[model samples]
Every structure is written in C-alpha cells, then in structure tokens.
Target: MVEPAEFRSYYGRPILKEPAWKQPDVPLYLFLGGAAGASASIAALADVTGRPELARAGRLVASGGSIASVAALIHDLGKPTRFLHMLRVLKPTSPLSVGSWILSPFSGLAAVAAASELSGILPGAGRLAGAAAGLLGPAMCTYTAVLLSDTATPSWHEAYGTLPILFAGSALTSGAGAALLLVPSVETGPVVRAGLIGAAAELAAARHAETGLGLASEPYRTGRAGKLLKAARALTAAGAGLSLVARRNRAAGAAAGVAYLAAGLCTRFGVYAAGVESARDPKYVVVPQRERLRR
Candidate 1:
C-alpha cells in the first residue's frame, strides 16, 4: 500500500541552473540561421539554373539573416565587443566558435553575392560566393542543434540524435518560404518540392523524438512549449498542403510562405523554452538519473 504524501520544509530554490542564453535573442538567432542557411542553398540552385531574380532574392535574404543572427548574439552577450572573444579559439567542443567561423564567411559571401546581383558586376565572383555559401549553409543550420544538445539540459541532450535532422528540415522550409515570398515568380516547382519534403521530414523527426524520448520529452508537450509546438505542427501541415498549389496561385504561395516562417520561429522558441524549463527544474534532472540507475 502507498503512504500519503506530506509537505516538507526546506529553503525553496532551483536545484539546477538555467543556461546563459537571453530571451528573444538566442531563439531569434536560431530561426534566422535556419532561414539564412536555406536561402544560401536556394541561391546556389538559382545561380545554376539561370534564374537571376530568384538568385538575387536568395542572396539578400541569406545575407540579411546571417547579419541579423550575429546582431542578436552580440546583444544577448550584453556587449558588442564580447563577440570577438568567440573568435579567439577554434575548439572542437565549442559550437559557438565553430558557428562563428561558419557565419563569418557565409555572411561575407552572401552579402557579396547579393551586392553583385544588384550591381551586375563581378559575375564570376558572385557565382563563387554563392557556391561557397551553399557549402556552408547546411552546416550553419545543423550546428545549432548540436550546440543545444551538448549541454546538461535533459530535453536537449536526449533528442540529440534527431535535432539536427529536424532542424535541417526546418531550414529548408524557411529557405523555400523566403523564395516563395520574395522571388517574384510563380514558377516555384523547386520551392514547393523543397518545402513539402522538409515539412514531412520535420514532422517525422519531431514526432519520433516526442514518442521515443520518454521523460525528457514532457516539456515539449506541456505548458508554453506545448502550445507553440502544437501551433507549429498545424502551420507546417497547412503550409505543406498549400505548397502543392503555390505555382498556380501566388496568393496561396505567399500564405504558405508566411506560415512556414512563423512555424520555424515557433519551433525554435518551443525547443529553447523546453530546455530552459528542464534546466530550472531539479526533478527533470534527478528523476531521470534515478530512473536510469533503476534500469
């Protein structure tokens, strides 16, 4: 028979510490990085296919997102100069350092490509820049997933195996969304395909993570995180369904693009919030460890 619980007295405080990330900035950075990475991929594709307008839009969005992501990081650090410290080392264990290195070149190349498109100068250089960004773009999106998981946060660490895949899918969705929104063309076959495939991948990965992650996945299905995740999933589903008709109806394409961007941002915020909650609650840590020991 189970005994009745009694209230215990102790100094009330969090048993675990929250991560050193700031609100709006870190999550914003994650969304922007994904958008930028996907833009770069689209830019490279457009360049190869002789679609100058599409290429221009992709380059500008990639450059803008890359620059904005850095600004958010600097703001989160509470000092513009503190960003320099992240560049001082290249440690394999430090995702910050690796991401800094990636973002710097990716930003510069993306900007140059966009500028060249506007000026109609240095076509060869622009192509080279676009090519480079294409290589770095996927890495930029996937690395942040690794960054969050390589921490003491249970919600993040347990889903490590699927986070990168999920983010990659999300990045493609945003990338395709940006193209649909800004490219000024109704021939969005590539965009639709990319978005549809990415949406499917994201849904599959997220569902699997939720189902298989056990206790660590609770935060993702409860409270603020749960609300955001639910909305994201709904938006992704609707956007994917609409993507099929994007080429026929520009308005539908635009709607799908907006939905995809919103969904991506929601996902970033949801995952970050869940990790923070897991970190702040000692039961998230202690109970998991205890259960592991029992097993």
Candidate 2:
C-alpha cells in the first residue's frame, strides 16, 4: 500500500507569510464595523416605520460603532495617513480601496444622522443622511469579508463562498442585539424578530463553512479557535432562544442582546485565529495544493 507523503517546511519555516493583522484590533474592527453597518440600516427602517426610540438607539449604536471601528482600523494601519492614502483614488478592483471609500462615507453619514437625532437639529438632513447611510450599510457590512477573502490566507480564501454570508448574518445579529439592549421592550418587535433571524442565519452559515472547508476547517475546530467558536455557538443558541421571550421581558431582551454581541465578537476573533493558523502551518498550504494538483 502506498503511504501519503508528509508535508514539511524547510527549517520549520512557514511556507506562507502569516497575516500581520493584530489581535483585538482587527477582530474588534470586524465586529464593530459589521454592527455599525447593520445598525444604520435598522435605524433607517425604524425611521420609516415610526419607531422613534428604536431608531434613536440604532443611530447611536451605528455612530459609536463606526467611530470605534475607524479608530481600530487606523491603529492597525499604524497611522491615520496610511488609511487616508487609500482614498486618493477609487479602485473597484481592490477590496481594500472600495472598503475604505464605503467606510469613510458611511461613518460620516452615520455620525451626522446620530447627531441630528440626538440634538434635534437638521431633522430633514438627518433623515437624508440616515437614508444614505442605510443604502451603504449592506456593502459596508460584507466588504470586510471580501477584503479578508481577497488575501492569500488559506482558510479565509477557501471559504470565500460562505464568508460573506457568515459576515452578513453576524452583522445583522450584532446590530439587532445592540438595538434590543438599548430600546424598550414595547418598541422591540422588529428588533426581536431580526435578532432571532440573524442568530439562526449566523449559526447555519458558520456550521456550513466548517463542514465545507475540509482540512482547511481544522483550525476552526481545534485549539484556541475551537474554543472561541464553541463559545460563539453556545451564545448564539442561547440568545436566539431567549429572544423568543424578549417581547414579554425587557431584561431577557437585554441579556439576549449581550449574548448575541459576544457571540459575534467571538466569531470574528475565531475566524482571524483560524486564518492565522492556516497560514502558519505548512501542512495547510501544501496539502491543499497537492490535492488540487492530483485532481
């Protein structure tokens, strides 16, 4: 019987360069950005539906999350100018450049709308700005997934088909969670429904990504990544169930919201950890290449 060849790197060096994205910074940005984007959309919908309190909460979360996300991204880049430099020209082909454009304008618009909502100034313009931000919300939410998948990271690139779906679901749940926590139970009908749906979608997509990734999925199911993902799953499951009774109990809604947010954060960090592992291990790189060649 023929034996499968073992893959090894020269002098134990990794065959691929691991991503330079720092812990907490990149993952935090991912979570906050996704939440901000989805929050903006929720705010806009709330405004249209005449839910002023929910709209107010959504706008505030969107603005706060956007500013924080920008801060994290700038920190990761080592300088604000490095982030600014990307805005020199629009590049449809580059996910980074496109994301920069989307993030910049979305942040400004969300901030403006939030300010208007809070200070009762320029209500007309605030509505317009909120609507515009909402228009850009979805792209803002999923663009980061594109940016990650565009890289050479093995796990991220291989899961490209589902990463965006996963991100969208995460974003929706995070946004809904924030709203559920801040808004009162009387005005939380839409938010509760959204949270439940987002939780379901996030859980389903994550499971699908793990199963479909084959060997590349190993990092997601073992070690630190495994622990985070396991926590995320549990949190999401619990939160979804709790959200069903949220309409009757405000405390339950708030607790479920916290769970969803924590789950989303864990998912982002877990994905980052898995990608780093995939790049660091030569086996992840070589085995995939070998299998591809054989096919």
Candidate 3:
C-alpha cells in the first residue's frame, strides 16, 4: 500500500493568505460590539420591567460599548474615512457592508437611549430608541462572526455554523456582566439568570465546534489560542458557579461579573488568534483541500 502523501507548500511558505486585520483591535471590537448589542436588549427589558437602576446601567454599558467598538473598528482600518467609505453602499452579500449599516444605526440609537436616560429628557423617544436598539441587538452580536466566517480562514470558515451562536452567547454573558457590576444584587435577578444561560450556551457551542471542525480545530487546541480558550472555559465555568451565590453576596456578584467579562474577551482573542494561526499553516489549507478533492 502506498503511504499517505505529505502536505507541503513551495519553499515551506503558507499557501493561504493571512488575515490583515489588526490584532487586539479587531478582537476588542468584537467583544465591545457584542456587549453593546446584548446590553441594548437588557436595557429595553429592564426599562419595561421598571427596574430603573438596571435599566440605567444597561443603557450606559450599551452606549459606551458601541462607541468603543466604533473607535476600535476605525482604528483597525487605519482611519475614520475608510470606515465611513464602507457606508456608501448597501450590499446584501457583503458581511462588512451589512455590519456597517447595523453598527451605525445601533450606535446612534444606543447613544440616544443612554443620553435620554441619563438626562431625563424625551423619555418617550428614549424608550422607543432603546426598543429599536434591542430589536437590532442580535444581528449586531452575530454580524462580526459572519464577517469572520465569510473570509477564507480555515478554522473560522469551518466553524461558521456554530460561531454565531457562540458569539451571541458570549455577548449576552458580557452584557449581563456589565449589568451585574453596575446594578445592585437586589435588582440583578434577570442579569444573573441570563449570564448563566449565556455561559452554558457559549460553552456548548464552543465544544460542538471543536469536535465537529475536524482538522480545522487544531488551532483551537494548541499554542496561544489553546491557552486563551482554556482560560475562557475555566473562567466562564467558575463565573457561572459563582453566579448562584451572587444573588446574596455583592462581592461574589462582582467577581462573577468580572470573570464573565474576562472570559468573553478571552474567547474573542482566542478565536482571532486561532484564525491567524490557521492561515499561517500550509497544512491547514493543503490537507483540507486534498481531502475535499479525494471525496
């Protein structure tokens, strides 16, 4: 029997083009966008339920996160004009274009809602804006994942089916963390419950992706990416466990919130690192293509 063929590229160079997106900035934008989207939803629900403090916290976090996300994206693009130029057209097939539209409107609405909530002006309009932002929250949370998956990155493309769900879960958890840190324990019942659910969903989706991605999952299980993802899993699990006790202890609640937020950050960075690593390895590209051709 003939031996299996060894995958190699000319001069040992990577066959796939690595992503040019700046590090830390892109991942930070992902985290902030997710947090902003989910926080908008939390703010709307809290306002409807008459939880004024929670609503205020959620509104502030949502607005702040959105602004930060914009700054990060613009920074990644190297200038403000580049980001603005993306808004010139609406392309249904382009994740970047669609994401820009979603992000722009959501940022404005979130800022408006937060401003009104803070200044106690135009409460009616603020409520409407907050509700509108909430309506767009889910799309905002998952659009980044779609953008990443739309690329040629092997690990990211292979996990596209589960990436959006993982991102949504992470977003919800991050939003809940912000609320828990700002609002008192007495008014954080919903936030705690949401965080628990988000943590569980994120963990589940990540596991499913790792197991189902086959060879593409290697990046997620090795090197810097592996370390970050492991930390994320541990922190998320610990935070979820702490959430049970957070209902009674403010300190525990704060710790849990921090843990959740940190975990979400780690997850985004881990995913980014994994994609970059995958692109730098010719084996990840060649082996997969060869397998497809063999079938």
Candidate 4:
C-alpha cells in the first residue's frame, strides 16, 4: 500500500507539491483554446465546401472560443498585462514559448475571420482568412500536449504520445459543449457524437500508455490524481455512450455535453496534479528511467 510518508521530502515536507498554478481555470482555458482552434478549422472546411450554416456557426464558435481561451490564459498568468513577455525569445524546447507564437498569429487570423463574416467585408478576403484560420485550428487544439510533455513532470513526459490525443479529445469536447449551449439539439447532435468519439479515443490512449509506462506512471493511477483520472474515465465513457441515444433529446444532449467538458477538465487537472506529485518524489524520476537504461 502507498503511504503518505513515502511521498514526503527530507524535511518531512509533502514530497508531492501542488503546482504553483491555480486549478480549474487553466484547464478550462486549455479546453476552450483547443475547441476554438478546431472549430475554426471545421468551419473553414465547411465554408470551402459550401455549407454556409455550418461554416457560419463554426467560425463564430471558433472566434468566441479562441478569444475566451486567450483571456483565460492571460488571467491565469497572474499578470495579464505582461503576457507579451512570453514571446521575448524563441525556444524550441519550450512548449509555452512555441504556443505563444502560435497563438499570436492564430488568434489574429481567427479574429479577422470572425470580423469579416460579421461585417460582410471583402468576400474574397473572407475565403483567405477562413482558410488560414482553419489551418491553424488543429495545431492550436493539439499543441498543449507538447507543452505539458516538454516539462520535467514524470506523468506527463512519460505519456508524451498520448497527450496529443488527449488534448485533441478535450478540444473536441469543448466545441461540443459550445454547440450544445448555443445550437438546437438537432443541429448539434453531430457535434456531440464527434466529441464522444474523441473522448473515447483519448481514454483508450491514456490507459494503454499508462500501463506500459512503469513506475513513473504510478502517480497517474494513485492519490488525488488517480481519483480524478478515474472520475474522468467514468464520466467520459458514460457521456459518450449516452450521446448516441440523446441525439434528439435536448436535456440528454446537454447533460452529455457537460459530462464531456467535465471529463476534459478533470483530465488536464489530473495530469497536472500527477506531475507535481511525481516531481516531489525523486524516486519517480530517477528510479524508472535508470531501470529502463539498465535493461
């Protein structure tokens, strides 16, 4: 059995420290950012294919989501005005740095696309803006995985490959949440279904990766992080299964959407928490890697 004392430091300090970051909001921002980016991409595709309604809705959601995501990110930074300091240099090893650069252009393009649609400005320009916005969407949605994976966090780095898929699923769920909140059940039904599929994919990938990761992965399956991961799995699975039958039921669809969103939030938070836990316990970083090398 895992004991609390086993996770303590030399001074009897809790070996697993809480992240300096606050909870809930940061993960929420990640979800929103992914959704916004994906929605923009989907909307651009619809526009190009002549699905005007889908295109319009996608663009609107994309714009709103992106803006909201940016706001959340800035707010979480504790100094919104100094956010630009993040872009002072380019560092390939740093996911946050790369993300800042990506966000700068992606957000601008998304804003332009949204504005062009609203103002009915230069029809030709709309196509260009839409296309650009759409292209950046997938990248925005999935890059968070890279950000977390680049860290020294054992749980995160050990599950590097799965992180991208997890982030993608979270992004899809965020978009589905927005769709359920804004669109009618009939129209948003497909979005919910898509989110379900994404969530399932995420859960499957995480589970498989976790099992193969050895001791470094233990934190993800134990303690507070473990509890959150279990909850996410349950909620996401239940929500996805229900989404199929809830296609025409507004209340059911709403509930499913909420569940997906919650699952996504829990996943990010759990991963973050697990990382903190792993970092505090030196054995997590040293033991596993050393064992692997000895093999």
Candidate 5:
C-alpha cells in the first residue's frame, strides 16, 4: 500500500501571519450583517405585498441588526468613534472599504424604514428606503466573504467562490429566523419558503467548498472550527427539514427558526476560526502553492 506523502516546515512555524480580528466582535458583526441583510430583503417583500405587520417586524429586525453590527465594529476598533475614519473614501479594490459604504446606506435605510412605521412621517419614503435596502442588502451580506477571501489565508482564498453563496444563504436563513420569531405565525409563508431555500443553498455551498479544496481544506475538517461547522450543517439541515411542517405549526416554526439562527452564527464563527487556523499553519500555506507550482 502507498503511504500518503508527508510535508515539512521550518520549525513548524506559521508561514503567514494571523488575521488581526478578535472574537465576539468580528463574528457577531458577521451574524448581524447576515441578519440585517436578509431582514431588509424580507422587509421590502412585505412592504410590496401589503403585509404591514410583517414589514414592521422585518424593519425592526433589520434596524436592530444594524445597531448591533455597528456596536460590534466599534468594539473591534477599540473606540466607538474610530469607525468614522472608514467613511473617508470608497475604494473599489478593497472589500473592507466597499463593505463599509454598503453598510452605512443599508443601515440608514433600514432604520429609517423602522422608524417611519412609528413616526408616520413620509410613509411612502419608508417603502422607498426598504426598496433601496433590498437592493443593497445582498451585497452587505456577502462582502465579508470577499474581505476574507482577498486576504493571504489559504483556505478562505481557496473557497472564495463558495463563501459568498454560503454567506448569502446564511443571511436568508437568519432573516427567516427573525421573521418567524417576531412576525405572526399565521403570516410566515414567505419566511418559511426563504428558510428552505437558504438551508438548501448553504448545505450545498459548504459541501462544495470542502470537497473541492484539497489540502487547504484541512482547516475545515479539524479542530474547533471543524466541529462548529459540523454542528452548523446539522442544525441547518434539521431546521430546513422542519420548515414544511413549521408552516402549519407555530411551535415547530419557533424551533426551526431558532435552529437556523444558531446555525447562521455557528457558520460565521466557524469560518472565522478556520481562516485563523489556515493563516497560522505553515502546512496549509506552503503545500497548496507547492502543488500549484508543480503543475
């Protein structure tokens, strides 16, 4: 039997430097972005469909996520005021800069839409805002993947193709969670359908990314990140499976919604952790490049 080839590194030291991001802040920000983006989409749909109550709930969720996302950003920056500097210019080549721009507009629109419902000021304006947010929301949801993929990390860069799809799916799932949790159960048809679609997409995207990555995918298969991702997949799948029945059962809807929300959070944290591991492991960085050069 042939033995697998062994790889070596200098003192087993990391080939690349780890990312300069902290826990809770970055991960939570990712979760909030997904939830916010998805909520914006749902809000727009609700508004267009004359579902006033659903629109209000979705707007509230979008605004809440926006607030949380900014708070996490401020926390990560070590100062609540430092985030102002990021608004200086729009850089096309930098995902971080682009994302910052996308977020400001999306957040502003979402908040306006939510507040308009209570204030009764320019109600039609709220609809327009929701429409704008709906257009921009998907970008807000997926740009983080671009930020991560553009980095020097091997696994993230290698999985760039699927990361956006995965994130978009997670965003939709989280949006559905917000609706199921906040909206009336009798009006959850749209949310349930969105959840099912997101669930299917996330599972397929994640599996596709893992299967195609070769040695670089090791970070996804080992350690805490791996375990978290596994749980995420399972939870997502289970929740998706329950969505059909959930349409008729409020209790089931609650359970499935919570599961989807948890799965979304887990997927974000897992991806961040896997990216960290990939950056910290010399084997991941060198082996892939070596193979590429050999070909």
Candidate 6:
C-alpha cells in the first residue's frame, strides 16, 4: 500500500487560515437563499397552474427569504460598507464577484414582486415581477457553491460540479421548512414531499463529493468537518424517510420538517468547515491534485 503523504504547517504554525466571516450570518444566508429561491420556483409553478393562493404564499416566502438572505450576506461581510466593491469588478473567475452580480438583479426583482403583491398598486406588475423573481430565485439559491468552489480550498474546489446541485437541494428543503412552519397541512404536504426529495439529493451529492473526489475529500471525512458531515447525512436521511409517512401524522410531519431544516443548516456549516480545513492542510491541496497530474 502507498504511504499517505505527510504535511508540514507554515512556520510551524497552523497551515489553514481561519475563516474571517462569522458563522451565524454565513449559515443564515445559505438557509434563506435556498428558501427564497425554492419558494419563488414553487410560486411560479402554482401561478401557472392557477392556484392563486399557493402562488401568492410562495411569492411572499420567496421575496422575504431573498431579502433576508441579502441582509445576512451583507452582515457576514466584515466590511459591510464596502460590500458594493464586490460589484465593481466583473471577474468571472471570482465566485464572489459572480455571486454579487447574480444577487443584485435577483434581489431587485424580488423586491418588486414583493412590493407589487403587498401594495396592489401596479397593474399586471405582480405577474411580471413574479416571473422575474422566479428566474432570479434559482440563481440566488445555487451560486453559493460557486462562491465556495472558486476559493483555494481543495475539498470545495474539487467538488465544484456537485456543490451547486447540493445547494439547490438544500434550497428546496428550506423552502419546504418555511411552508411547514407557516402554511396549513393541506398546503404543506406537497411542500414536505418536495423537501424530502431535495434533501435526499443533497445527501447523495455530499456522499459523492466525499467518495468520488478521493483524497481531496479527506477534510469532509475527518476531524470537526467530518463529524458535521456525518451528522448532516444522518439527519437528512432520517428527515426524508420520515416525511414519506408524515402525511399520516401531523407530529411526524412537523418533526420531519424541522429535521430537514436542521440538516440543511448542518450541511452548509459542514461544507464551510471542510473548506477551511482543506485550505489549512497543504497535503490536501498538493497531494491529490499532484497525483492526478502524475496519472
């Protein structure tokens, strides 16, 4: 068997640099962005299908979630006043810059949709805004993966293709969480099903990221990041399974909904932590890619 490569820290200090952003705001943005985007998609579906009430509710949730996500993103940036600097540069290679561009238009459309819905002042504007909101929603929901993937972190960069899908699934699950918390059982049932499917997909993506990525996935399989990933897998699986039977029991539905939400949060946190770890370990960055090149 080949011996695992050894790594040394820079100057005998820690190899990985600590993440500068606060935990709460970053995770909150992940949750809210997912929720908003999913809600908008659902709302568009409902509208096209002639379910006005469901459409309206979806629109409201999507709009609120998007607005909250934007705020959370700004808060997570240490220099809130300089957040706009992200927009000044159109660097396609920089996930942060790309995300800023995606977010600006999406947030504006969400605002218009929300205001039109609440004020009833714009004739036919609600429909147009809703359409625009729906378009931007998915962009907001999945771009976090790009943001993380663009970084120097080995684990995240290696899992770039899978991250967007995982984030999208998490977004759908979060939208279901909001619906379960706010909507009636009659309406929330389908949302719960949607959430379950999304959760399952997210879990599968994470697993694939871990196993298919080979050594790069070490950060997700060991230490603090590993623990969180394990927890996320367990919670998401349990929640998705339980949601299938939740229609028979209100308590089960509520529990599953809550579990899905928690699982989504955990998944995001774990991914973030894994990135930090991957960045810290030179072995993670150098060995795997080097091996790939050698092959």
Candidate with maximal lDDT: 3
lDDT of 3 at 56: 88
Instruction: Put down candidate 2 lDDT per residue, 1-295, tens digits, no spaces.
Output: 8898777799888888999988789999999999999999999999999999988988899999999999999999999999999899999999999999999999999999999998999999999999899999999789999999999889999889878988898899899889888988888889878887888788887897678798888888888888998899999888888888898988889988999999999999998998998998888888888889999
Off by over 4 Å in 6: 1-5, 13-19, 246-248
lDDT of 3 by residue, 1-295 (tens): 9998777789887788899999889999999999999999998899999898998888889899999999999999998999999999999999999999999999999999999998999999998999999999999889999999999999999999989999999999999888878898999999989998899899998887667788999898789998998899998998888888887999999999999999999999999999999999888888888789999
Off by over 4 Å in 3: 1-6
Model 1 lowest lDDT segment of ten: 4-13
For 214-289, candidate 1 gives per-residue lDDT tens digits of: 8888888888988888888998998898888888888988999998998899889988988988877777777778
Point out the higher-scoring one by lDDT: 5 or 6. Answer: 5
Per-residue error for 58 in candidate 4, Å, reads 2.5
lDDT of each: 0.86, 0.91, 0.92, 0.76, 0.86, 0.78
Pairs with steric clashes in candidate 2: none
Q: Residue-wise lDDT of candidate 4 within 103-170, one digit each (tens)?
A: 87888888888888888998678768878988888889888888877776777788888779877876
Model 3 error, position 15 (Å): 1.1
Predicted structure 3, TM vs. truth: 0.97
lDDT of model 3 at residue 15?
Answer: 84
Residue 27 in candidate 4, Cα distance off native in Å = 2.2
Query: Taking the tens digit of each residue's C-alpha lDDT, what string does model 5 give over 219-279?
Result: 8867988898899999998888777787678888888889999999999999899899888
**TM-score of every candidate:** 0.95, 0.97, 0.97, 0.84, 0.95, 0.88
